[model samples]
Target: MSNFATPETRFLIGATGSIAVTRLPEYLGALRTAFGGSYTVLMTHTATNFLSPHAVGLSAERVIAREAPEDWPTDKPSRLAADHDIVLVLPATANVLSAAAAGAAPNRLTTVLLATERPVLFFPHMGTAMWRNPAVRRNVAQLREDGRIVVDPVEHADRDVVTGVVATHPALREPDGVVTAVRPALAAS
Candidate 1:
């Protein structure tokens, strides 16, 4: 035998389009520092609207956006996916969740998800209404059934919601949350 338990690990982080994109710096920074592992960030096209690719990159040219050149090879994702130990999608959008559940790989991020057998941990972020939408709920159920892990977002009353009718939920995943969730998974893998 061979034991899968190993210390050094590699991570593939997929950051989706969500306002929580702004806080990724803190969480990702912590994961890189505390986890002692290298990570590559694959940002969705819309995610760039919230933060620049350079900012997400830190010092390494490890960040790749969805807007690849037309000449970029179609098999790039599989080649990249083969290198990572796990896949974690932070600020995962409702649309992304649905697409993954529906087996739609429109972008490199989803392509990586499909092309690899690596474990996936999805941290979904969206408004309360969107989170509770029938389709979104259905997708979440399907994803869970398919063996994808999720870190549930906390719901709180938004300052703008004076009536408290709907809670504004954001997946502002802190560094501690990332470290806590990733450590056990990394150890097992």
Candidate 2:
């Protein structure tokens, strides 16, 4: 067990982009089981297409979606930041990575990121080609330089439906793996 695996630890889960967002329930359940901590979920507009806020709420103390500012549980991003111990951007899309690297607050999730002094962990998920893109590589480097923990996505074999050809792609780490990474990521920072 990790030293940080305490009941009082608070986790802010920022869900971004597609596919991997569908596994949020599993992720939340794993975190709750591993750390016995409270969880709050913040979703990007695109995340809504993958999973509903109510689904996320089933495992979280609070759920905030970017499109529905009226449903925000906190008055400001800084307040939310102050309340949480760490920020985990799961399924971090290239868009959010670029935005964070540039210090742009174009959305609610990014706004909270900008306000938080907490350790930020990014678990990036994208195609192999996109993950290897020059701009994406630069953004990841910038985020690391800025003191954020960016976990490299694991390689997974993905099959193309049309061609029936298998290709290795950058995939989100399993929930347990992510929970395990958090400790070292925090310790390093």
Candidate 3:
């Protein structure tokens, strides 16, 4: 693909289930504002709990989440990789990370994660305990080894009454951080 060296205007976003899922509109707004491109957001099945498919659909050119009842077009993943330059995963949960590390394609998000040949940026989000888990770290390391860009999470704690531990605030909150990490993927044209 001749376009691999430069940035692309069409972005495919893979969002997972996390409290951070609610901030998608803000993130998409900033990216669209700064880069002037179209956005397509695909939410993991669990993600729909926190964000509405219709609402996300309103903000983006298209929306496909795990909750979508109809099967995704089987050919869309490759078509997407061909047409879009960037693939971003925000709040990449441990389960999804594990699935991606193994190259599993049981669902649309993981399928796109594996199928896309374009730059894939992952912003991992989870509780400190979960993030620190050995399995999670190994998966993160593996994905990074495979060339994914991971913007480190910041320190923000909101205590859970049940868990009594703080969950992280994903870097996705700062659209600037996403833009910063994506610049390398778009350096030339």
Candidate 4:
């Protein structure tokens, strides 16, 4: 038996195009400090544009971000979903939100969202108006109905002379010092 408790959190960090991408290091650092021994991070291609896979690798034991067809599983839906404890989408773009809600998997990130059996957490980041758009609202409503956890977005003044919202997860809340040892249960509250 080991003296240290291994956390069961296998986090798939999906990123879409959003200004919040600059904050990923803070999030990863918090997870590392809290979980210590159990945390995996996977990134989306769009996300890699903002941060390097090498940087992400510093926090996670393994980092995956390939779009090659051969990289996908032989199974119809792929098997990455089967291997993770949870899928978290940070700085989720309006486009990705629409894709996930519409069941369209155009890339690895969306594909994982479509296939994962565990809890899916989405942190939407976009302009306030886009966040409130009817289509986006409907998609968000549908995702929630489908049992996905939609972390509330934080509002901030944007350089574009508008308000922007960035979705946040518990790992971004505060350092808990305890690894999230299992897939978090979905809570409506």
Candidate 5:
């Protein structure tokens, strides 16, 4: 391992089943504009549903998709943490938020979340009702308490229903050198 400080930062974009996935191209463009030569991106399966791997791969200058161990040369574990500095989960869904809060690592994205020692940033997007759910609230609270950066979503009228709440705007700026540490909430019996 190299002893260099401030290795080039790569973004791990873990998107769940949110409409926000549709905006990936813009997000990727923004990231490229901001970080350009300094970032690489990895995408989640659900995100691929909205955007093609080729598009994201072209934008990031590398392949973008899930990383499975069985895939071997195609999906190496090291790729998630290799020469990277941070993991940012944009459009994080309630399900993923709950999984992270519960320390579950069932899928590739969640598994990467568990493996990365770098700072984690979560930008959650979902219905206002779901955001306010006790479980989601607890998860958000826990993630915040655990030293993860949780960016607040901007509320707006739902395009689908025309009256209900939805997350319309994105939190775009990237923070520098933010670190969050997690401590167990309770002592083991």
Candidate 6:
């Protein structure tokens, strides 16, 4: 395998179901602008609920929404794994994190997450309560112990659209912060 030390590092984005998914276009744009690398997105079924597949396709070189192995390119995970330098799970939902920690591959995204030899980085997003759940904390610990890069969620005050009640949530970091974390991962990879 070729070293991904150049500016041409490739990224495989494993997008999950999270309200934070609404920021994908901007996040993808920032990643491209900062690294000038190729990006391919693998979307979960739930992800479609928040954003259209077409929207993700517009920002990535390829967008794969298939769950079945036959739906993927030839040789499946090997081909996809070899095509990227890193696997990024942006807006990683608690469910996905637990599955990953348990080494479950129920879907295409988790399949790649399990198969990839490249570094896997997770950016978690959820309410503060869920983020602080004991089970969730244990899962996050397991992921880190297994050598995955799990970015801690930044606290953000989100105001309810209808009630105007502002409450703090564990949110995805700013695009620049994400890029900062990715840079070192790329270098180490």
Whole-model lDDT values for every prediction: 0.78, 0.87, 0.76, 0.64, 0.62, 0.88
Off by over 4 Å in 6: 1-5, 68-70
For model 6, what is the C-alpha lDDT against the true structure?
Answer: 0.88
Residue 122 of model 6, lDDT score: 98
Candidate 4 Cα errors over 4 Å, as ranges: 1-6, 73-77, 158-189
- Pairs that collide in candidate 1 are none
Candidate 6, residue 182: the lDDT equals 87
The alpha-carbon deviation from the true structure for residue 35 of candidate 4, after best TM-score superposition, in angstroms, is: 3.5
Q: What is the lDDT of residue 71 in candidate 1?
A: 23
Residues 126-187, candidate 6, lDDT per residue (tens digit)?
A: 98889999999999999999999999989899899999999999899999999888888987
lDDT of the structure predicted as candidate 2: 0.87
Q: Largest TM-score belongs to which candidate?
A: 6
Residues 122-180, candidate 2, lDDT per residue (tens digit)?
Answer: 99999988999999999999999998989999998988899999998899999888888
Candidate 1 lDDT over 3-90, as tens digits, reads 2323356778898998887888877777766665667888899999999989988833388876556625733888768988888898
Please identify which of the two predictions, 1 or 4, would achieve the higher TM-score against the true structure.
1
Badly placed stretches (over 4 Å) of model 5 are 1-7, 67-70, 161-189
Which scores greater on lDDT, model 1 or model 5? Answer: 1
CA deviation > 4 Å runs, candidate 3: 1-8, 66-75, 159-173
Worst-scoring 10-residue span by lDDT in model 2: 66-75
Worst 10 residues of 6 by lDDT: 1-10
For candidate 4, write residues 1-189 as lDDT tens digits.
122324555566676766666676677676556444444556667778888878877766667766766855532235777766666676678888799988998877788888888777777777667878899899989888887867656544434335454443222222231124222432211
Give TM-scores for every candidate, taking all chains together and pairing residue i with residue i. Answer: 0.86, 0.92, 0.84, 0.75, 0.74, 0.93
* Model 1 ranges with Cα > 4 A deviation: 1-7, 59-61, 69-75, 161-167
